[model samples]
Every structure is written in structure tokens, then in C-alpha cells.
Target chain A: MTEMLRVENLRVEIKEETILDGLNFSLEEGVHVLLGPNGTGKSTLLGTIMGLHKYKVSGKVYFYGEDITDLTPDQRFKKGIFLAYQLPPAVRGVRLKDILKKILNIDPKKDLPVEIYNYLKSLDLDETFLEREINYGFSGGERKKSEILQLLLAKPKLALLDEPDSGVDIDSLKLIGEALRKIAKESNLLIVTHNLKILDYVVPDSVIVLLDGKFVYKDGLEIIHQIEERGYDYVRRLVYAQNLS
Target chain B: MLKTYLKEIRERALKAKDKPAILGPDIDLEPYMRTIEETPIDDLEKLPDEIKENILYSGITPSENDKAGTYFQINHSVVYEKLQEIYKGKLEIMSIQEALEKYEWLENYYSRLIPPDTDKYTAWAEIKPTGGYFIRVFKGQKVEHPVQSCLYIKEGNISQNVHNIIIVEEGAEVFVTTGCLTHLKDQPGIHIGISEFYVKKGGKLYFTMIHNWSEEFHVRPRTAVLVEEGGVFINNYVTLKPVKSIQSYPTVYVRKGAIARLYSIIYGRKDSYIDLGGRLIFEEEDAKGEIVSRIIANDSSKIYSRSEIIGKAKGTKGFLDCRGILLSKSSQIVAVPILDAQHPESELSHEAAIGPINEEEIEYLTTRGFDKDEAMSTITRGFLSLEIPGLPKVAKEQINYAVAQLEKAGL
Candidate 1:
């Protein structure tokens, strides 16, 4: 099996406050779920891995065994790494079609290709939605759908999605989950989610528990059942016992 | 009657030429008074290659295809003026001097909306006037294509004073695209333009102006519009090139059942100082007015965007929107929007915002495969792309062409 992503002793600080400290993790080429509590720096970890400039990062991030910690976000994107933001910013005057044209290198005078139109339909979005300002007035479900649509268009080697199931309705979750499953068939997916509801639509190969900026436990789908029944405090105590031993 | 009106206005202008304007830096008129003669050309192909290229940059095509009429002025001469044969009697295009000599009734609209003594620039335009276009749309006729005009300044260190008049008769509609530019890139020059537009009852007029002047040009354009009852007027203005200084505030009066909208997209670059604004007055009941302005200030440029909407009659409505972006540390942008409602039944509102480009937006674009510079450029172009309401197709195409040209010039 080939390693898709590896983070070695990663420490992230935003505005001089440490958010993720001494985090170490590695993932293979498959679908993985990241489970954490609120404010556990799940989004921050994803952003740091994508090379967002806001975070003060110290440590190493490897994509397919290549050092990528110092690369810019655009440079990282060119190396086949992508992140679906937890909350996408609203760019007031930039239309979705305009950005799509830039991403696909399509001429401004030509229409968007048919595959994107098919993706729009599968996401239950109108064709006219491409003309709207990007994320300007989108609903919660619509924003998630837009992220998933972009993921399908990009087809990167590794995808980092933050809480793709949080604000989505059940129907949109099914659509987005199906899209992620399709993406995972060709690319590795590391998704941050709070609940097991999304698990019903897309099965994961492994589930990792992150507590206090470090991975506490890693297991198959059975770990999610334990966490749901006994909660993260149980896992915390179990990890504490192991550390003491 | 035309001769008498011209004489009286010229006298007033002479007396007020020394008077200072209410805003912007004052300039001495003595240096620019020296005129250089340019021979008139009946065909556009006779223009120099550099001159033609500059005109094209301002959104005017030398071929004149798909246009209702074409007017070209170089320095103080009207080089070419032609109207498409298909629009023979429905549309009229000629030099303002010829129109004044040919029709006596033109005196009514010559300086009616904007007084010659309103400001020093207007005064200078009347005192040492150059040739400008006189366009008219016949009653009950709607011209499909826009009439294109190019005002080019070939000689440096001279003032090009021009006065233009546009009249749309009752139930008629027309679109006019004007491009103002200069051939010299670094020589000192000044252009004073006084434009008056009148829209009769049930008439519609769409006016688009693109300015592509050089770095050392000082431009002062005074424009006013009078819309009769049930008329509509839409004005679009774009100035993306470098200029030494520019100050303009076009005012419009909307009567009963009339509507007026003014849109301005201004990009200030390279030490340019631009003070652009517009005012709309609702004069009677059921009148509507709107003002929208988008400004981008870069490279130590300074811009002041001002908009005012006054509602004086019952059932009147007005709104103003002003947004700007400062791309450089030294660049400055000031937005001032004012709304006054005199009548109890009138409604007026305004919105103004000025700040640097959003970092989050830049970061978002970078994650979508754009480098830093490309991300910034994309955001800048998006900032200037405004969805103007009620604009004709031809006018929109012209504005798009102007923006594309600016982009090609590394904007």
C-alpha cells in the first residue's frame, strides 16, 4: 500500500496560540474519517496541510513521500492536494463560472464543458446557479454542494474535507456523500466529521480519534460504535492508561 | 438665433474663465490656449497607425462596422463624421458647429442643461470651443446600434475644449458610445468637455463613455441630463488609464414617471487623482433614480467617489451605492454618499464602503489553483464587473471591450 499523506510532529499556532501541538499521523490511499470535539483544530489541521498562510506551522508535511510544508497553497494545489473549506468565504463579485473557467483553463468566450453541467445536475443545482456570485447568498446545503462539485472538478490526488456533513440536510448529505465516495475511488479522502450519520452513506476504511491536538486512537468502523456508545471521555481514559503504562 | 445664443454664452464664459471651481486643483488656462491646427480627413484609414491603435484601446473601431454612425475628432478638427445609410432619416450625426448652422432649434438644447458659466472648465469649453458631436434620434424611432465617437488629442501642451449635445425625441431610443483619448503619453495637456443631454417623453437614451488618456493629461468633463416625463436615461462611465487629474460630477433631473441610473467604473493608477461623482434629483411624483460606482485605486493614486440623491416630490424613490478597493499601501479611496428626502412620501437610501482587497478572498482563489498575482488580478477584475441594470446590449459590449483592453494592458 502507498502512503497518501504523512504529518510528522506537526505543531500549528494561530496568532501566537497553539492550536495543534505535536500531532503525528499517516494515512494510506483510502477513505479515512477524523473524529474530534468542537474547537479541536480539525479545520486548522486541514488548512495547515493545504498551506494556508494564516497559520504559523512548525513541522513537516509529506505528500506521497515529498516534503510540502514550505509550499504555497497554489504550489500545493499543483502537486495534487486539495481542501474543501469548512466555511468558504464569500467573494462578492466573482461568479462561479468565472472561477471555473480559470481552473479549467477554458476560454472566456466559450461555455463550461458538459461534465460540469452533469455534475451540477447530480448536485441538484440549477444551470443558472453558475452565474451567481460565489457563495454570496448560498444556503448551508448549497455551499456544501458547491464544495463537493469543485472537488469532483479538481480530481486531486488527496482531498481534505472539513465537516462536510455538519450543516447539510439529509438529502444533500446523501448527494455529497455519494460524490465523495466516487472521488475516493480515484483519490484518497480524509474527512472531518462529528457524527456517524454520513457513515451510513459512504463507508470508511479507517476512523481516527483526535483529542487535544493529537490522535488518541485509530481503528476500523468499530471504533465509531465505541465512541458513540461510551463517548470520547472513555477513549481519553483508555489512551491515558496506555500512556501511563 | 443660434449665432446670438453662441455670442451671449461666449461672453459669459470669458467673464467666468478666471473663476475657481468648487472642487479639485485649479489650473491656469494661459498655457493651453495656444492651438495647433490638424487637417480634417474624410476617411478613418487616413489616421496614423499609433493614433488608430490608441483609439481602439478606448473602445472605438476604425472600421465603423456594426455602428449606427461614426464621429472622429483630432485635436480641434472633426476628421470624420458619417451615419449609416440604413439610419438615414431616423438618426442624425454631425459636428456641433454644423448642427448649429443647419438647424435653428438646436439652440434650445445647446447649453440648456449645463450652463457655460457653471464652472471654469465649462466656461473654457465655451470660450475656446473645439469640435464635438451633435447626435439626435428622430421621434418614434429606435436606433438598434450605437453611434461611436472618438475624441483624440494629437498635439501636446494644448487644451481641447469640446461641447457635445444629444437629444432623443419623444418615444425614441438610442445608445451613444464615446471614447476620449490622447496620442501623447507623457506630454502635458488638458481636455475640457461640456456635454448636455435631453430625453423627451417616453424616450430612452443609453450613454457610455470610456476615457483612456495618458499620464500627463488633465481632464475636466461637465455633464448634465434632463429627462422629461416617462423617459429613461442610463449612463455608464469607465476610466481605467492613467491621468494627471480628473474631476467630474454629472447631474440628472428625473421628472414624473421618469427613471435615471448612473454607473461609474473608475480605476486610478500611477499617481492619478480622480474625483468622480454623480447627482440625481427626483423632481416630480413617481420618479426613480439610482447611482452606482465601483473604484479601484492602485500605485499611489487617490480617488474620491461621491454620490447624492435628492427626493423632492411624493412617491419618489432613490438609492446610491459606492464601493472601492485600495490595491497599494499609498493609494487612497474615499466614498461619500448623501441622500436627502424632502417629501414625506419619498424614500431614499445609500451605501458606501472603501477598503483594501479582502485577504480571505485572495487566499480562497489561491487554493483554487491561482498564484498570488493571478489571484489578485482575478479579484480586481471581478471588483470592476458590475451588473448594470437597463443597459443596452451594444453598450454592455462596449464596456466589456474597454475592460478587456484594460486587462490586456496589464491592469
Candidate 2:
């Protein structure tokens, strides 16, 4: 099997405080989930991979056999790496239609392409919402829907989704899962989620449990089902037992 | 009597008092006044054809079959006018000289909003202006096409002062777009525009003014609008080129159930000092007002944005939004927004922010596909965008064209 992503001793620190310490993981072309308790550096790991300057990282991150540790967020984006942020910035005076136009590099005088309108229809969003300001006064579910919509348009090779189901309503979550389900067929998805309910709609091929910024278990989707049934405490016992050995 | 008013204003202009602190003490009024006296007005036949062709750029010049009226001014004089079929008998578009000689009703609105006694600029205009335009829309008639005007400077080492009066009678609506430009070779001249607008009860007036002058030009505009009950006044001002200096503080008065919306988008570059703002006075109950300013300072420019809203009656509401972006560290932007509420039930609010364009937003744009320059252009467009729901579609397209031109010119 070919390795899609390889992290060698990844360490992240933010403002003199260590968030992720010595995390090493490798993933192939498949759907994967990172499960951990609250404040266990799940988001930090994804942010480090996405090249956010908020954290200082010391590690080697290789994608498809090439080192991408020092690449910029935008640079990685051009190379087919996309992150659907949990909280997108509310940029005043920037409309959704305008942003989409810039992203797609369409002529300003032309109407939006039919493909995007069709994608929006599947999400049940009004086409007129394109004229409204980006993320301004948007509800939680609406924000999530917008991120997923961007993902569908971006068409990345490696997708890093940070808490895509946390604040989303059940209906939005189902819709998001359906969209990601289609995306996972072509992209290697690393979903950082706490809610295991989305797994019912879009099942992952592999599940990795993170403990204190370290991956403790590497197994198939059955491990995720086990963790869901027995809760995180069972994983904690296994994590501590493995660390002691 | 007019001579006495002129003498008073000339004396005052010599030693203008209480000038804003931002203007500093280095301002010398002697050069402008001297230029006004030394320069001679040119004959119409001797002028270049560009003076008339400039009106074509304003998109207001009437075709052979068109009924929309137009007034073109060259060196402070109205050189051409076309009040066609629809506006022939009912509407009146005349030079200030013609109006003073032909109509007695002009006295009721002339200088009523911005009197010659209001300031030195108005006073000087009263004393020395060559010519101007006087427009009166009949009561209850909606003017579908915009009345266009152009003020072009053809002479060097001179000053041009023109007074413009616009009156929308009761229940009437009119749109006016003015272009103020000077020749590229103008040698250190001054342009002072004094305009007064009156929107009668239930009337509406939409006005747009675009300024493009040479590097050696100094511009000073004095304008005021008075809206009666249930009236509306919308003003849009855009200046996207370099000039020596510009100072304007236009004002509007709102009556019961009336509204005043002021929008200004300015680009200051190449050592230009631009101080632009608006003042809204809520003089009656249930009045509303909003002021929005977008200032972009590049090179060594300095920009000062001012907004003052005064609520004197109950149930009045006002808001001010000021945002500035600086492209260079040497450039400066100062925002001063003041709110005065005398009545307990009146309310006013303001929001202001000045900074360089955000690196994160630029990076976010790049994540999609845009390079650095494209990202910056996109962000600049977003910063200057305004939500003008009631403005005409042509005005919006003109704004987009102006912004694109500015961007292309490396502003």
C-alpha cells in the first residue's frame, strides 16, 4: 500500500505551551478518523498539518513521498490540501458570490457557473445567499454548510476536516456526511470528530485513537465501533496499558 | 450689496479663522486668490473640443433622439445645455445668469441651503464665479434619466468657482451625476464648487460626483442639502486620483420621517492631503441618517475622515461607519466620528477601523487559486464595496469601472 501522509515525530507548541508532543502517524488512501477526548490536541494536529502559523511545529510532514513541513497554507492548498475550518472568519463586505468568483477565477461580469448552483441546491441553500456577506450573522449550521460547499468546489486530494459535526445540527450533519461521503471516494479524508454518529452515515475504513497527542491504537473501523460502544474510558485503559508496557 | 458681500468674504478668506487642525498652518490662501485675479477666461471658440467631449464620458450627453437634459461647464461658465422634448416646457435648466434674469422663484432656494455668508469659499464664489447651473424639477414629476454636468478646467494658473443649485419640488425625484476634471497640464490651480440641494416634502434626490484633477490642483467643495418631511437625499462622492489637497465637509438636514445617506470612497496617493466627511442633522422626530466612508491611503498620502451626527429631536437614529486601509507605513489615516444627541429618546452609533489589508484574508484568497496581486485586488474591492440598495444600476457600474481604473493605475 502506498503512503498518502506520513508524520515523523510531529511536535507542536503554541506560545511556549506544548500542545502536541511527539505524534507519529501514517495513513494510506482511505477514510480515517482521529478520536480523542476534549482538549487532546486533535484540532492542533490538523492545524499544524494545514500550515497555520498559530502553532510552532517541529516535525517532518511528508505527502506522497515529498516533505511539506514548511509550505504555506496557500501553497499546500494549490497542491491539493484542503482544510474545512470549524470556524471560518467573518470577513466584512466580502460576499459569497464574490469569494467564489475569485476562487474559480471567473469573469466578474458573468453569472455564477451552473455547477456551483447545483451543488448549493443539494445543500438546500438559497442561490440568493451568494449576494450576502460572507459568514456574517450566519448560524452554526449555515457556516458548516458553507465550509462543505467550499470543499466540494475545491476538490482537494487530502482533506483535513476539523470537527465537521460538532456544532452542526443533525440535518446539516447528514448533509455534510453525504457530501464528504462523495468526496472520500476520490480524496484521502482525515476527519477529526468527537461525534461518532456521522459514522453511521459515512463509515471510515480506519480509526486512530489519540491520547495525549500520541496515537495509541491503529486498527480497522471495528475499533471505532468498539470505542463508540464502550466510551473513551475503555480506550484510556488500553492507552495507559500500552504506555506502561 | 453683492459687492459688499464679496468684500467681506475676501477679507475673511485672507485670514480664515478656525481652520481644522489637520490642515496645519502652512496653508497659504494668497496663491489661490492671486490666481483667480490674474487668469483670464477664454472665449468659447478658442477652447478645445475635449471640453465638450468630456461630457460624453459622464454618460449623460443626450443623443439626437433622447429627451434627457444636460449642462456642460468650462472654466466656471456654462457653455452648453440640452433640455429636450420632455423637459422643454415643464423643466428648467439654465445658467445662473439666465436664472437670475428670468426667474423670480430662484430667490427662494438660491443660497438657502449654503448661503454666501456660510463660509469664505461660498462668499468668494458669489463674488467671482463666471457661471453655473440652476436646475428645478417640476412638482410630482419623476425624471427617469439623470441630468449630467461636467466642470472642466482649460486655463493654466487660474481658479474656477461655480455655484450649482438643484431643487426637487414636492413629490418629485431626480438623479444628477457631475464630473469635475482638469487638464493634465493645469499649473497649480484651484477649483471651488459651491452646491446647494433642496428636496421638498416627499421628494427624493440622488447625486453622484466624481473628481479627477491634475497633480498641481487644489479642490475645495462647499455643499449642503435640506430635506423636508418624508424626503430622501442620497449622496455618493468618489475621488480616485492624486491632487495637491482637498477639503470638504458637506452637510444634510433631515426632517420628520426623512432620511440622509452619505457615502464616500476616496483614494489618496502621491503626497495628497484629502480630508473628506459629512455631517447629518436630525432636526425633527423619527429622522434617520447614515454615513459610510472608505478611504485608501497609498504612497505618502494623508487622509482624515470625519463624521458628525446630531440628533435634536425625539425618535431619531443615526449611524456612522468608517474604514481605512493603508498600503504604506508612511501613509496616515485619522478618523474622527462624533455623535450629539440632545433629546433623551434620540440615538446614534458609530464604528471605525483603520489598518493595512489583512495577510490572513490574502492568504485565504490564495488558497482558492489567486496569486498575491489578484488577492490584494480582490481584498481592496471588498474594502471599498458599499451596500447601495437604492442607487441606480448605471451608478453602480460606473463605480466598478472607476475602481478597476484605479487598480489598473497602481493605486
Candidate 3:
């Protein structure tokens, strides 16, 4: 299978402060879980890979084997790389459905598919939210699901989701994970999240533990069980020893 | 373009010997043959720059400093000369002198509608031979379409004394639109115009005007409307660039139970200065009047608006609303709303709001792939289009076209 995304020795600094230090990673055509604690540069890595200007990256990034380290966010977006931000923005005077339809380039004369509305309903969004500005007054979970709705329409080759299960309830979380597992099979998934509760639904093939801007371990689902009980102390010791060596 | 047009008009005037619609002193040419035979033509090349600037500043009407009789130079004057050369016999237009000489009956009613002391510009314009347009819609005669009067100001430091008297007789309705324009390549110019509208009892009159002048020129406009009982009057005005200083005050006086509405919008940019407003006075009971004015200023421009709604009737109602937007840090706008209700039963309401565009909204739009400039343009159009529901179709289209041009200019 062809590699969807590849990062080689990625080093990023924000205002002279190092965020991602010499990170190297790749994703094939399946589910890949990226587990990390707070302040571990998970979200920063996602932003840098997506070409968001909030950080200054100093390494090469390749998408579908094409160099994209200097591409703008819009240019990268047009090349089929979607990033689901942890916090969605509020756009006033622009209706939610209208924005989605325009961005997706759907036909205006025809009705949108019922399956999309069903997904929105499953995520606890209502008709009023669709007519209002995009995420103008939405709650945390609703905003997340709106992002997912955009993801389903855009259908990017690489989906980098930043904490998809952070603010969702149990039922909605299950629905979101299920939706991802079903639709995300056509592309490579790079899930950067702290919570492991969604793993039972997504059922990752491999799990990587990122600490201090570098992956410390690569294992299977058993790593999630180990981290849940042992509480990242061993990983912290490994990160310290690696820094010293 | 101008030279070609002027040549055609000169040829037409020279060929037509039959006295065609003369607008100045009715000289038989046979009686004053010797005086016309000796008038010098070399002095007509162009007025001196100092004299042009002086006339521009002093409100360009001819004066008699020397008691040399002056010979009543009809063809040399701007109003009579231009009217004689172009559009002489096509339309029913006349200079004040010509009207007094030939149509002498009009002198009693010409400046009577807007007398000399009615305002400062009128008082000063009364010196020269003012041009007058007497449009009388007969009783119960409703013109199927509106009549248009196009006036152009070309001479430097020349005061265009136009006295427009529109009489809508009883049970008659007429729509009149006047356009005042100046060519782009013309020298520095100044115009002082006076338009007086008289709506007789049980008649309707709609008057609209659009003014476009070069920013180097100074303009002072004074117009008035007197609506009798059961009469309706509507006025709309717009001012554009190339005009340096503009001071306009359009007033409406409506009788008992009459209806009046005034809508005005002014956009200022690039060192422009304006002090414009409208006034409405109610003399009878149950009268209704409303005025809404919006102004936008940017780039070291200044605009001050002072409007008033005076109600003397017992149960009359009036509303005054003014809003403004300041785009640049150097721009300034101030509005003063005044309401004087003499009777306790009368009502008046006033409101105003001024601020910049919100930062959060701009950021949101920028994040969605639009740049800061595009976002600002969209917000400006949306803000101005909020008043489109009440305007007529042609006016609404004009506002939209103006906004498009502003965006194209990257404002």
C-alpha cells in the first residue's frame, strides 16, 4: 500500500521555543492511533503538517510523496488533506448548510443526501443550527460533529483529527467513532488524542506513544491497557533517559 | 469630444438667422447694429486665471465696477451665450434677462418662489441674469413620464444662476429628475444653484437630483419644497467626488395631514469636506414626516450633519435618525439631532450609533479562507444594503453599482 503521509526529522519552533523537535512519522492506508499526554506537541504537529501558520516548521513534509512543506493551508486543502481542529471557528451571516454545500461544490438545485442529515441528527445537532451561522452558537460536541460532517463531504486522502473524543458524551462518542470507522476505511487515519475510550469503537491496528515531540513506543491495543493502569510514569522515565543519552 | 461638439453647435447657431428662442435682452439687431459691429472678439479666448479664481471664490456673477453701460453682452455671458449656441430652440429655457424682456409676465413669479433674501446664495445669485425654467403642468394633467433637465457647468469661476420653478397644479401629478454634472477635464469651477418646488393643493410632486463635480470645485445648493394640504413630496440627493467643499440644506414644508419622506446618503473619502442636512417643518395637525441619513468617512475626511424636525401642530409626529461609520483612524464624523416640539401632544424620536467593524467577525471570515480586505468589503456592502427594502428599484440599483465601483477601486 502507498504511504499517505510522511514526516522526516520535523522540527518546529514557535517564537524561539521548540515545540516539535526532530519528529519522524508516517501513516499507511489504515487506522493509526497517536496517543500522547498534554503539552506533548500533538496538536502542534497536526497544525504544522497542515501548514497552519501558528507555528514555523523546519523540516520536510510529504503528502502522497509530493513535497508540501511550503504549501499554503488553502493549497494543501485543495490537495485532499483535511485537518479537524480542536476548536472550530464561528462565521457569522453564513449559514452552516450553505457553507458546507459551497465548500463541497454540491449542486444547489438538488437536496443534500439524507444520510448527511442523519449523521447530523445522530450527533445531536438540530435544524436551527443548520440555518444559523456555522458553529456560531453551537456547543462543544455539536461543533466537533460539524467538523466530522465536513470531513465526510470533503473525503480527504489523509485525515488528521485533533482530539475527536474530548468533549463528547458516551452515546455521541460511540456514534462519532463508528462513523469514523465506517467512512475512514477509504483513507489513512492519524488520530491525535489523549482519551482511549474511543479506541474500542475505532479499533486501531497500531498505537504510538508520543512524548516530548518524539514517539517513545510503538505497540498494539495492549499499550492502551498498559497506559490506562500504569499512568505514563514509565514513558516519562524513558523520555528522560532518551534526552540524557 | 468637446471641440467636435462645440463646432457643431457653432455652425448651427450661425446658420439659423431666425431669432430662435433667445434667452437674454430681446435686441432686434436692426436697432443696435452699430453696437454689435464693434464688440471685440480677442478678449473671449479665455478668462484670466486670477479673474477665474476670484469669480470662483466670490460666487461668479457679473458685476458693474465701471459705469460703462456694459451693452448687455448677451453672447458673451455664460448662461445666455451657452443657451444661445446649444439647445437654443429645442427646449423652453430662458435667461432671467430674456424672460424679463420677452416673457415679462414671468418676472413677477420667477424669483418670487425663491426670493433674493431666502438664503445667502440666492441673494448673491440675484446679481447676474439668472436662468429660469418655468414648467407648468396644467390642471388635472398627469405627464405619463418624468421630465429630465440636464445642466452642465464648464466655465471657470462661473456662477450658474438657475431658477427652476415647478408648478404642479390642482389634481395634477408630475415627476421631475434633474442631473447636475461637470466634465472631468474642465478647469476649476464653482456653481451656486437654487431650485424651488411649489406643489399646489391636491397635487403630487416627486423631485430627485444627482450631483457629480470635480473635487477642486466648491458648491452650495439650496432647494425648497412647499407642499399644500393633501399634497405629497419626495426628495432624494447624492453627492460624489471631485468636489472640495459642499454645503447643502434641502428643506420641506408640509401643511396639515400631508406626507413627506426624505432619504439621503453621503460617502466621503480623500480630504473631502461636507456639511449637509435636511429640515422639515409641520404647520398643521396630524402631519407625518421622517428623515434618515447615513454617512461614511475615511482617509482624513470630515463630515458634520445637523438635522431638525420642528413640529408646531398639536398632534403631529416626526422622527429623525442619523447613523455614521468611521473607517480610518484619521477620519472623523459628527451628527447632531435636534427636535423641537412646541405642543405637548406632538412626538419626536432620535437615535444614533457609530463604531468600527468588529475584530472577531473579521478574524472569523479570514480563517474561512477570505483575506482581510475581502472580508471588509463584504461587511461594508452588507451594512449599506440594510436600507434597500424601502428604496425604489432604480435608486437601489444605483447604490449597488456605486458599491461595486468602490470595491473595484479597492476602497
Candidate 4:
């Protein structure tokens, strides 16, 4: 499989506080799960990879063998890189359909394309939601569903999803998981989540465990069971033991 | 009786001619006192292409298509006036002078809402009343299309003073769009407009005004409205272009079970100084009022946005929202939202927010494939695109057109 994304010696700092230290990872064109505990820099890694300006990134981030560390978020987006924010900001007065029209380059006077309409249906969102301001008063589950809907519409080569399954109800999780499974067939997904319930619908090709801002373990689905049996502390101890040996 | 009323008004105006406004910088009225030549045309096509273009930019259609009537005033005279035959009896659109001369009872409605001695601008308008539109919708008739009116200033150093009156009879409905503009940039001018609006019992009136003035123009519009029992009044105001200074604070009085909604979207550019606001006073039970304003100040512009909702009667409710955006470092926006509950059963609330554009919103848009500039423009457009409740389709379209024009002008 061809490598879709590569991050080398990635170090991120926000306001002089180091979040991600020397994180190195490479992913092929498949579904990958990033498992980590709270405040383990999973979101920072995703934001850094997407070239968000808030993060002070020191290392190089490459997409399909091209360096994109200095590129803006829009430039990275043009290069088929998309990030679904963990907590999307509520933009008042900007309707979701209007932004979708802008992203699709559709005419202002024309209706939204049928494909997006179908996506809305598949996500179990009402068509009237299009007229609502983007996530302004949306529920937690609805916000997650909105993020997934954007992911499905963007269909980027590399999608960095931050906590796509968090704060979602079981019903919405199933809908979002199924949508992700469909999009994973055409795009590469790097999903960050603490819960493994979403794995029931969309199986992961590889599981990467993040500890202390670094990828401490990388394996198949067995790592998920190991962590389920013995919490993230087990993985930390295992990685510490390996470094000591 | 009319002559006596006029004499009394003139005397009162003369006394208040030197009185300064409570807000905004005082303008020296001497420079704009010079008189300019008036051009009155019988046909709309006779208007110069340049002047017509400016009029169109202010959201007035020059062709008069889809309009119930058209009133064009240039300098101190009415250039052209036309009313569609379909609205001949149901609606009336004519010059204020013509209406006053033709109708003996016009004096009762004129200057009744806004007194002539309220301020210097009102005083000036009463003393040298130029041409303005007089529109009235007959009782129980609903005018389908909007009546378009344009107040154009053609010469430099000219003072254009006009008094406008609009009356919506019982159970009547109408929408009026007025565009006030200048002919050229940097042409010093002063416009003092005294407008009085009356909405009868159960009547509805939607008034939308767009201002496109030059950098050397000073505008002071004194407006007042009276909403009778169960009547509705919707006012939409947009001023997107540059002006030397503008200070207006239109007030509305809401009677029993009446509703008043005032929406303003202002974009201040260059060295403009704008102090715009609206006041609503609820006088009877169950009356409701709302004031919403969106202001964007760019360049070195200074804007003061104020809204006041005074609940005086029992069971009256009012809400005031004032939001402003400062696009440049030197730009300043001051938002003042005041709510006064005088009666024990009255309820009033207000919220005011003034700040620069949200960086997070801009970045969020950029992540959706929009460039930084595109993101900023999109966010700015959204900030200014307010969905005013109960606005007529034509009025909303006019407001949207003005906002789009501002975007094209690189606002």
C-alpha cells in the first residue's frame, strides 16, 4: 500500500507549553484508530497535521511525499487533507447550507446538490438543519453527526478526525460509524477516540496507541483487547519496559 | 388652519436652529446653506446615466418595474413621479407639497409624530422643506409591490431638507423602499430628513431605507412612528458607504397590542463618524418592540450604535440587540443597549456586543477550502446578514442587495 501521510519527529507547542513531543508516525491508505487517554495530545497531533496556525510545529509533516509543514490550513485542505474538529466552533449567522454551497462552489441561487441531500438523509439530519446556523444551538450528538457529515462530503485523501465518536449517542454513533465505514473505502481515515464502541461498525486496519505525546505502541486489533483488559497504564508500563531493555 | 400651523412650526424651528444634538459631532450648518439649481423631469429616462447608476446602487430600480410607484427627487425638486394604474385608488404616492395642497386634513398627520423643534436637523428640514414623498395605503388595501423613492443630491455644497409622511390606514399593508444617495464623491453636502410614519389599527408598514452618501456629506434624519392598536411596523435601515458624519435616532411609539421591529445594518468606512440608534416606547398593554442592529466599522471610521426599549405600560415586552464589528485597528465601535421597564408588569432586556472579527470563525471557514480573504469576507457577510422577523420579501431583498454591494465595494 502506498503511504498516504507521514509525520517525522513532530513536536508541537501551544503558548510555550509542549503538547506533542517528537511524535513520529506514517499511515498507508486504510482505516487507522488513534487510541489515547485524556490530554494525551491526540487532538494536537491532528491539528498539527492539518496545519492549524495555533500550534507551533517544529518538525516536518509530509503528505504523499511532499512537505506541508509551513502550508496554511486551506493549502493543506487543497492537497486533500481534512480535519474534523473535536469541538467545532459555533459560527453565528452562517448557515450550514451556505457554507456547504461555498465549499462545493455551487451557485448561491441554486439548490444544494442531490448528493449532499442524500448525505443529510443518511446522517439522519433533517433537511431544515441546512437553514440553521452552523452548530450554533446543536446538541452534542448533532455536533458529532455534523462533523461526520462534513467528513463524508469532503472525501479527502487523508482525514484526521478528532474524537468522532465522543459525545455521541448510540443511535447517532451507529449512523456516523456506518458513514465513516463507507467513506473509509475511498479515503484514508485517522480517527482519534477513547471509546472503542465505534469499532463494532467500522473495523480498523491498524491500531496506534499514543502515550505521553508519542506513538508508544502500533499493532493490529489485539492492542485494543490488551488496553481493554488493562487500562492505558499497562501500555505505558509496557513501553517503559521495552525502552529500559 | 394649515397656514397657522406652518407659521407656528417655523417659529419653533427658528428657535431650535442653533440647538446642538445630544450625540455625534456638531456640524457647522453655514457651509451647506448654499442653494443649488433644481432639475425637474417629467420622464424617468431623462435622468443622467451617472445619476441613475448611483440611484440603482442605493437599491432603487430606475426602470420602475415591479414597483407600485416611483418618486425621484433631485436636489430640492421632484424630478419624476409615477404611480401604476393598478394601484391608482388603493395607494397614493405624491410629493409632500402636492399632498398638503390637495388634502385639507394633511396638516393633522404632518409633524404630529416628530415635532419640528426636536433638534437642529428637524428645525432645518421644517424651515427649508424640500421635495419628499407622501405615500398612503387606503384602508383594507394591501399593496403587493414596494413603492420606490430616491432622494439624490446632484450638486456640491448643497443642503437638501425634506419632510416625508407615510400613513397606513386600518387593515392596510404596504412596503416602501427609499434610497438616499449623492451624485459624486467628496462633494460636500448636508441632508436633513424629517419623516413621520403612522400605522393605523391593525395596519402593517414595512419601511426600508438605504443610504449611499459620499465622504463629505453630513446626514441627520429625524424620524418617528406611531403604531396603533394591533398594528405592526417594520423598519430596515442600511448605510454601507462612506459619509462625513451621520447622526440619527428614530423613535417609535407602540400602542395597545402593537408590534415594532427596527433592524439596522451599517458599514462605516473611511473617516466617517456615524451615531445611529433607535428608540421604542410602549404605551399600552401587551405591546411588543424589538431593536436589532449590526454595525461594521472599517478604516478609521468611528461608529456609535445605540438602542433603547422603554416599556411603559402593563404587560409590555421589549428586546434590544446591538452587535458591532471593527475590521481595522483604527476603527472604533461603541454599542449601547438600554432597556427601561417603567411599569411593574413590563419586561425589557438588552444585549450589546462589540469586537473584531472572530479569528476562530475565519479559520474554521478556511478549513472548508476557503482562502483567508474569502473566509473573512464570508464571515463578514454572515455577520451583516440579519434575518429580521416579519420583514417583507421586497424589503429583505433590498437589504440583501445593499449588503452584497458593500461586499463588492471591498467592505
Error of 3 at A177 (Å): 17
Q: State each model's CA lDDT, in order.
A: 0.88, 0.79, 0.63, 0.88
Local accuracy of candidate 3 as per-residue lDDT tens digits, B1-411 = 333433443344344433321111121222211111113322322543543332321112223221111111211232212222222232233343454456545544555445455544554444432354555566676654444444455545455555566777777776555556565344555556777777778777766565666666566666777888887777666554436667776777878877676766666777777778778888788777888777778787788777888888877888887777789899888887889898787888888777777655554344334456755665555455425234444445444554445564467
Error of 1 at A8 (Å): 0.6
By lDDT, highest first, what's the ranking?
1, 4, 2, 3
What overall lDDT, based on C-alpha atoms, would model 4 receive against the true structure?
0.88
Residue A242 of model 4, lDDT score: 78
lDDT of 4 by residue, B30-50 (tens): 667766657678777778899
Cα error of candidate 4 at position B68, Å: 0.4
lDDT of 2 by residue, A1-245 (tens): 78989999999998999888888888888888888888888888887887876679998999888899998777778778888877777666778887777556578768877899888977889887787787888888888888788888877888898888878887888888888888887888999888888787677878888887765467788777678789888888887887789
Docking outcome class, model 3: incorrect
Q: For model 3, what is the error of residue A133's alpha carbon versus the real structure, in angstroms, after optimal superposition?
A: 13
lDDT of 2 by residue, B1-411 (tens): 444443555565445332332342234433555322223223333345675454344333435243357677767556677676776655678777787667666666666677565555566676567667888888998887777777777676667878888888999988888888875554887787888898999998888888877778888888899999999999988888888889888989999999999999888988898888799999999999899999999999999999999999999999999999999988999999999999999999999999989876776666566666877887788778776878777667666666667666774
In model 1 chain B, which range of ten residues has the least summed lDDT? B400-409
lDDT tens per residue, model 1, B1-411: 778988998898888988878878898877898877788787788889999888877778888778899989889988899999999999899999999989999878988888888878888898888888999999999999889999999889999999999999999999898999987987999999889999999999999899988899999999999999999999999999989999998999999999999999999999999999899999999999899999999999999998999999999999999999988899999898889899999999988888888989999999988899988877887888788876777788777777777578786
lDDT by residue (A1-245, candidate 3, tens digit) is 77877888899888888988888777666788888878988888887877876577888999989999988665676677777768876654455675566446576345566776776776666666666666768888887888787777767777888998888888779878877886577766788887777777787877878887766466778878778888777767766787689
